[model samples]
Target: MKSFRRHTESHRTDSIGWLRAAVLGANDGIVSTASLLVGVAAAGASPGTLLVTGVAGLVAGAMSMAAGEYVSVYSQADTEAADLSRERSELEADPVAETRELTAIYVGRGLEPALAQQVATQLMAHDALGAHARDELGISEAFTAKPVQAALASAASFAVGAALPLGIAWLAPAASLMVWVGLTSLLFLALLGAVAARVGGASMAVGAWRVTFWGALAMVITAGVGRLFGAVV
Candidate 1:
């Protein structure tokens, strides 16, 4: 019995749900807020105006992330529920056919036909719905959509990420506010990317470069537009 006991181990898949939400929220918050501030500063916006704009961006971005994540994740959850419901009906209406489907799935996965049939029958006997949901539908608890969790995570991470540039903008001199916010935001994004990559078991440098590149591009374009508009005005 002791030898048969299962040992626990953690995998990156376990954190997939929250990790994705956090990374996206944080990246968007930083990039958007920083770009906004830099663009405004380039347009010769006063310090007071910059701070106000940053604060407003932070609030709006956080709320947007929360609502967006909730609706998107809810849609996924709804789809999954519908699928499970349909699967349940099939299970109840024609269990024999369902069993054959399961057996065929196992056969496709390299199991012998006789062994696949036996395995499928035993699994269905144990928990028909669960087995079908996992193997047939590719739905499991780890991948199950949780709208509330996703929304909260996105909102919280977005606020946190937005605060970095906002704080820097508040403290930095007005003469160089754009440079300060832009440089520091890139640093923040690099760190965010590296940390996210590390957690997700990817190349830190690659992730960092990927995020920083996009952020830089956004800031540059926004600043250019602001400069152009300011000169025109």
Candidate 2:
């Protein structure tokens, strides 16, 4: 007799939910905080003022990210639930039609009609709602909306990202605060993009360039506005 091995595969789809929230939160945190500090510094704000503003921006950004993620994800969860409920009712009302629908879906996916019908029949017999939810509605355990999880990940990542520029602002020489914050924040954004790309199985260079470009643009515009205001005032 030969020994058999049961192999399991892991995919990035499982991490999509939290990964999206975390990346968005951290990117926003770094860009917004760095821009805020650079803008203020360009306006000749005192070190004390820069520190206060950076801290305030960090706190506000984190809270906003949390609230935004929670509300949005909760709405998604609600929609998914409503869809599942409707699907369940439809399945109960006309199980035969639902089976046909599932069969059509599988057939569309390249299975022969008769084979699709057989597969759909077996799956529905085993778990009708599960079949409909997964096949028809495109909802699955791995892709389910998780509001609390998204909220926490967004909030925590935002705070951590914001802290990088904030700490630099607090420590850098007052005259060159903007320079330090801008450069360091760009580096932070690039690193974040690379890390996120690695996790999501994307090209690291592309991800880093994408994030760094936007971050740099934001800081430049903000700094220009601050300089204009400083000169006028």
Candidate 3:
């Protein structure tokens, strides 16, 4: 008889960077585009004008998200590179000090001093820079910055999210466009939040409520402002 083995899998923390960018981009796209549509519609703008505004917002928001994500992630990458360079210099100048530093860190993390020294020595022998980078500098390949990936994910997700409200605005009757867009946008926000929370292993209800509340507030505020300005003008 052949023996079978079970493999255990765990959540991937590496997804944190891209997931955060995507979620933020999508949420902003939905809220901003929907709010813009509602605001314009409330101001008695024609259906064609409202649709045009939404389409413009979708395109602008996607571009903004991509550029912002790329810049921010690239900054992080630069910082990490600088830190690694400094660490390499320190290691080259005084390898003994570097080993002691690693040993001290392990000891601080609840290891016996002797065991910590042993572990550090072995780890440094295997891969000095890697061990120090992870243990001392708190940097790892899993969390490394990938600007291109982040930018693409953000732009793509933003476009997809923005399309939902735009589609509703285009199809709904002019008189009822505001209501349809508002309600459907909130629903989309709730779903996005719930799904994001689930994927991140968080409380789905909290995520859903948090996003829905903020989205509602944004639309209400925009609509009120538009109405006030329309009346005044």
lDDT by candidate, in order shown: 0.95, 0.95, 0.93
What is the C-alpha lDDT profile of model 3 across 10-107, one tens digit per residue?
A: 56586887898899989998999999999988888999899889999999999999999999999999999999999999989999999999999999
Preferred candidate (lDDT higher): 1 or 3 = 1
Q: Residues 1-233, candidate 2: write the lDDT tens digits.
A: 99888755778988999999999999999999999999888888889999999999999999999999999999999999999999989988999999999999999999999999999999999999999999989999889999999999999999999999999998898878888999999999999999999999999999999999999999999999999998899
**Which ten contiguous residues of candidate 2 have the minimum total lDDT?**
3-12
Going through the candidates in the order shown, the clash numbers are 0, 0, 0
| Comparing 1 and 2 on TM-score, the stronger one | 1
List the candidate 1 regions with Cα displacement exceeding 4 Å: 1-3
Report the lDDT tens digits of candidate 1 across residue range 140-190.
Answer: 888999999999999999999999999999999888888899999999999
* Candidate 3 wrongly placed segments (more than 4 Å): 1-10
Best-first order by TM-score: 1, 2, 3
Ten contiguous residues minimizing lDDT sum, candidate 1 = 1-10
TM-scores, all models, native as reference: 0.97, 0.96, 0.94
